[model samples]
Target: MLHRLFILLIAIVGLAACSGGNNFSSGGATDVARSYTLADFSFAAPADLTVSESENYYPFADVVWRGDPRGARVPQIAAMFETAARRSATGLTGDVPVAVQVRLVRFHGVTDRTRYSVGGNYHIVFDMTVRDARTGTVLEPARRVTANLDAPGGSRAVALEQGGQTQKVRVVNFLTEVLLAELS
Candidate 1:
């Protein structure tokens, strides 16, 4: 009778463990969204400064991942920088004496099940150069800006989308801060 009772107890414990609500097989997971704050920039700009143009140097122009084409991503990123620069230039009244050129240095997004539980990470790098409108003299050297963002989702596609959205916000904030700090 004691041997039978021991076997019953073991079965009960196994059932309880299997019945717990926290199940990993269903892909239920969560991750923390990172937060960012703009830095206090303190550089003086010429009174007649202006934004000239934005450019993209992302190497993989025709690459695709998970049904998304690289053509789409590259243009979107370039447009973001252009829009941000224009927005930042709104309050300034000038004769377009100087133009700000933006260059996208790198954009990398990756997923690793071993590294992240719910999602992966995205990294973006860019540079801004200020030059004289007429003579092309370099007023300020290239200023590099970078951001590492977290993309949290249950699947790889979802994670990539999240990372792209986060990158947009970071880029806008970074550009705005740079313009306000150096060109204001």
Candidate 2:
């Protein structure tokens, strides 16, 4: 009976959230969106990332971005964010345009050992602030958001890589959907 009650409560919450035409659940990023759509938003890349210093810096780094065809630079991530932002703004017919200033705090990719032994999540941590797109006025204060993605390991990882679902692809697609949800 308790289980049924819990499930019913969850269903009610889901309905309430979706009633606003926004779902807080997706691939990895959860509740990163608001209820209403904005006029527009753009992704602005960080000038430089603060990477990990330790040799095994696989985990403790803010700017540990990798697996980008265009280069492991933070700009690529910004570009991906831009693409996703554009996708998210498709329904933005309002008058308040905004820019998402992203400062990558950490982008932890799975190490080879972890990738082969067991899969993990790409820990993407960043600080985001919304500003007026036309002017430089700040609209929203900075907030830290984590948008993680599962990193498949071993043969499964290989298969995904071959299918063109590289980390870059997956991340980009995930961000797009996340932004869509966030702005919707």
Candidate 3:
């Protein structure tokens, strides 16, 4: 009998942990930035991920939400950026090879009704480092790329999509642009 009670309690706790305890609305929605600009590298974005709309990550609330406790997307994006950095600026030849390191920290949320469809403000930071592939010399110190997306609606789903891919793309583009500018 005692074992049954313990099992029930464990099940309840597991369920609660899985579901983020936030009442998110699914009515309003908008894309923060369909796309962003950068030099040498450009990529398309679906939407911006609003930190506010993130049920688990409440930047303003002084909370950090590890959507994937294993830390997945951030590393993937960082690897992509590093690969971009290593490629030569030229088409297929005469491009200097380089390497880069990236770190994506927690993001910040602001209130901006005009820019983002998310209807709130979004701010995220990615720290990066660049080095020469051949000489192994440090090319740039860690940089923090920040951007805000439009969240015109008050929907968490919209915000997640935006903040997840769109915002990261912009930041990656921003980093690429900065790197290209320096190289030029």
| Candidate 2, 47-69: lDDT as tens digits | 55565323231344455445653
lDDT to native, each model: 0.44, 0.59, 0.40
How well does each candidate superpose onto the true structure, as a TM-score?
0.43, 0.63, 0.38
lDDT sort, best first: 2, 1, 3
Tens-digit lDDT track for model 3 on 74-139?
344445456455442432232444554545554433322322323333343455455556776755
For candidate 2, the per-residue lDDT at 3 reads 100
Q: Which residue pairs clash within candidate 1?
A: none
Displacement of the residue 184 alpha carbon in candidate 3, Å: 5.9
After TM-score superposition, what is the CA distance of residue 151 in candidate 1 from its true location, in Å?
4.0
Q: Which of candidates 1 and 2 reaches a greater lDDT?
A: 2
Off by over 4 Å in 1: 1-70, 91-96, 109-117, 149-174, 178-184
Mind giving the per-residue lDDT tens digits that candidate 1 earns over 52-131?
12221111322111212334555555665566666666654554455666666555433233113333334445565666
lDDT of 2 at 12: 47
Model 2 Cα displacement at 3 (Å)? 46
